[model samples]
Target: CLSSQHTEGNVGTKSEEKLIELIPLIISCSREKHIWKHIYVFLTPGLKWHSAGVVRPTLTVLPPSKEEDKQSSATVVCLATGGFPSNWKLGWTVGGTSTSSGVSTSLEVLGTDGRYSWSSTLSLSADQWRKAGSVSCEASLSGQSPVTQTLDPDHCSE
Candidate 1:
């Protein structure tokens, strides 16, 4: 026989708490029964179960450098930081359309605060950039709404 129970209680302070699940298993052999207990704990702050340990990434879109402005091609960088789990994906969109050409993404780097940071660079021709409309960078995680930052080239300072 197997049974499970869930319990919640405060941990450390009033702003922090944890959810604990206890599962008890019973085994029978030769008319004898033994019981074993398993415990699982989830640390939650403020007793909020939504997103729990998951932290949404902050996104930033950087305009092209001065040197790039004089060149035939321009490069823009998208930075995503302060996210947990290290599984976030960074993507780029040009004029509301997904694009992969001349796009490079870096591996997720672990930070001192136990979060993750990553970046993606998009390179476009000078002519394409002027007509790119709106460039957007998106940081997405499974089952969560993506965080996006958009930049309009026409409004950027040279």
Candidate 2:
């Protein structure tokens, strides 16, 4: 596997060496700042701040217990957290086929860390849960790739 490293450099510098690295950025920001503002004015209407980082969501699947399955059905909750912009989509799929029936989705909640969290529940029949197939939960954001978590029905035990 290939890995990468990131280094943070101080933007406010008093030394000439540090200043040399920032000269190009400083000059460009001075001239193009106005242009960028004009270009993004409509895009960021009434926005005070914007998050630059694209935080991928963390997904968790809560399988139903055996007792709960006795009612001929199971309830599985998919939790998605630590995402940004509060505009995410959560979905459920069984064996790669999407399902909307018997699904309830919650609204996005903002956390103290400025990220967002959301959850969705899928209600499946006990037979569906016992089919030994895969159930997947997917989370996605506009202009970004989707993140998914899967659970095997065969692995769910009493």
Candidate 3:
């Protein structure tokens, strides 16, 4: 069963009191066969609100690994961190064109501070990387502007 409660309090030294609702989320996990356990969780205060209070994610674009630079192909990674909720999506673009082939995205990882982090990787051939003008990583959420980070291949060091 799910229960909700409405509460009001002052947040961050503001004189006005904010109204927040507490919604219980129940998760079930099984440690062994036929053995099931349930855990009840509640979101932090600021996260209890709707999209108006959504936390934007910080994006970082990492250059190609040194080991991969020695090979025929190269890989770049994009990491998005400190976003609220787990519904954000990560996408990649190479030279201003959206590229999905040889791309991999990881599942959202929930942090103890009530935020989420995710990562995406893009793989390209050595020849392609050299000529590729710019690579971008964008994190998108519904009803919000996407956060994008761009990296120039020419600026990257071996």
> What tens-digit string does per-residue lDDT give for candidate 2 at 1-158?
11112112332334433221101111122453543211010012222222234578899999988887888988889999988657789999987899888899999986655567999999988988888398999998777889999999888776
Please give the range of 10 consecutive residues that has the lowest summed lDDT in model 2. 36-45
**Candidate 3 has which clashing residue pairs, if any?**
none
RMSD in angstroms between candidate 3 and the native structure over all alpha carbons? 11.8
What do the candidate models score in CA lDDT, each in turn?
A: 0.74, 0.69, 0.74
TM-score of each: 0.68, 0.68, 0.69
Model 2 error, position 12 (Å): 19
C-alpha lDDT of residue 77 in model 2: 93
Quote the lDDT for 57 in model 3. 93
The TM-score of predicted model 1 comes to 0.68
Model 3 regions more than 4 Å off = 1-41, 44-52
Between candidates 1 and 2, the one scoring higher on lDDT is: 1
Cα lDDT of model 3 by residue, 1-158, tens digit: 22223223421221134333223433224434544322223344344432223678999999887788788788999999998657889999999999999999999886646678999999999878878899999999887899999999998986
Tell me the lDDT of candidate 1.
Answer: 0.74
